[model samples]
Target: MPGPLLRHVDALVGVGVLVWNLTASQFGELSQQLDQGLDRARDFVTANLPITDAQLDKLVKQTRDGLSGSAPDPVGGARTAAEVFGSILLALVLLFFLLKDGRSMWRWVLRRMTGPNRELTAAAGRAGWRTLGAYSRGTMVVAAIDAIGIGLALVLLRVPLALPLALITFLGGFVPIIGATVAGTIAVLVALAANGPTTALLVLAAVIAVQQIEGNLLEPLVMKRQVQLHPAVILVVVTAGTLVAGIAGAFVSVPIAAVAWRILDTVQRHRAADSA
Candidate 1:
């Protein structure tokens, strides 16, 4: 678990750095576009709304000044960094102990149980573990496919920061439906800002095509056997998890659901066999 999670964190950091560099390199052009967009917005508001040009100008100025304000407090930043580091350290220590003693702990639990109950417990545990493993592998395969498909389209469209965008897509693919949509939207916006409407539309179409293939074809083929949950069920589970616990909940929910389903199935099968 920590292995895959650490890799994800690394990927996220890489994507962030790449995106930051891309944005920095294109800052001048982006600023010009922003100013032009603001001008258009002001014109539209002045023409259609009750607001005066002076009021609009003041609002825009305030917004711009707020955005361009001084950097964040170093002390607060340091405190946040320390907290993050402490959390990571604690996680690593827990991971170490779990890795070292998990099997022994499982055996101890099984030893305390008796007869059919022990057998059922063992079977359910094994099933849940297998399901979780299958989910991890299947998700990675699907994410790779998404990243590759979207990256190729961006390359063909000559979109700037295509690689970083593709990396973002790959990372987003881990979160299932919602992640992919957000990543695609970011790609479309970037294309629109950098390459205009036609290219942005093309990118959007490609994203949709890739996502369709992922959802309708790749997911069913790759994940159905492992997860065994309906698309709607997965969607609902993800949504509930997100509402309850944000990104961490969303990330873990599907695997938890899959494992729980497998465990229940295992227990039911054993019960039926024993009754028969």
Candidate 2:
């Protein structure tokens, strides 16, 4: 097997083992905590809202039955696994070819264009490439900061599975806004289950503070230099990408938008120069 493929396989196995151990040790405890929390919530709702105890009980029972009836199919699980494996294989192949032939490929593309258009295309391509590189580096820095900040809070709170949760946060950071939110929610829930509501609230506060700093300070400082984008534009692009292509789309949307913007800016400048 190729080195990249072997590395990917190793990573997958490591993650699987980590997840298995976490589930094996903590599943029962988490479930118990969840049940207790739900009971407390039910009581509070019954006292505050216009619902009767009997109605709340019926609603809870129906929800549980529905969840139980919706257990995942083994065949579907196997199929999804196969699809994931195939995607990894395809990505590896593409990466290898791109690494090996990128310059030649770019030259080939340039050869297909003519005169000023060729120069414009080359300039735009270079700008887009630079934007992508900047985005990747800046994102990694931001992600690392997020993971470290939250992971430290988890450790201070004595949360279980802190390492694995931190790893998830780091990976999730790649997906931008949605990714961080989901990862933080998981961390908060784990804190609630293992510790209590107070710990959970602290965890929530930590997550929010880290995310806000990353969004307002870190990202603007790191990304604005090369990949200038408004927060509203980023949100819109992320939402549209999610609607169109789910998680994969969300992961890629921001970089794609940034690169596109850089390329358009380059083209416009070239056109203006010619006109002048």
The residue ranges of model 1 lying beyond 4 angstroms of the native Cα positions read 1-88
Clashing pairs in 1: none
Task: Give the 10-residue window scoring lowest on summed lDDT in candidate 2.
Answer: 29-38
Q: Could you tell me how far off, in angstroms, the CA of residue 27 lies in candidate 1 after the best superposition?
A: 11
Which digits, one per residue and each the tens of the lDDT, describe model 2 over residues 1-276?
Answer: 457966976896897688667656665655565566555556767999999999988988999899778655899869877876898799889877876678899999999999888999999999999999999889988988998999999999998767667777887898877789988987887777677779889999999999999989998998877897876897899999988866777888999999999999999999999999
Clashes of each: 0, 0
For candidate 1, write residues 92-187 as lDDT tens digits: 798667666778888999999997899899999988988888888889899989989999999999987776677778889878788999889877
Candidate 1: deviation at residue 195, Å? 0.7
lDDT of 2 at 270: 91
Cα deviation of 65 in candidate 1 (Å)?
Answer: 18
After superposition, candidate 2 runs with Cα above 4 Å error: 1-81
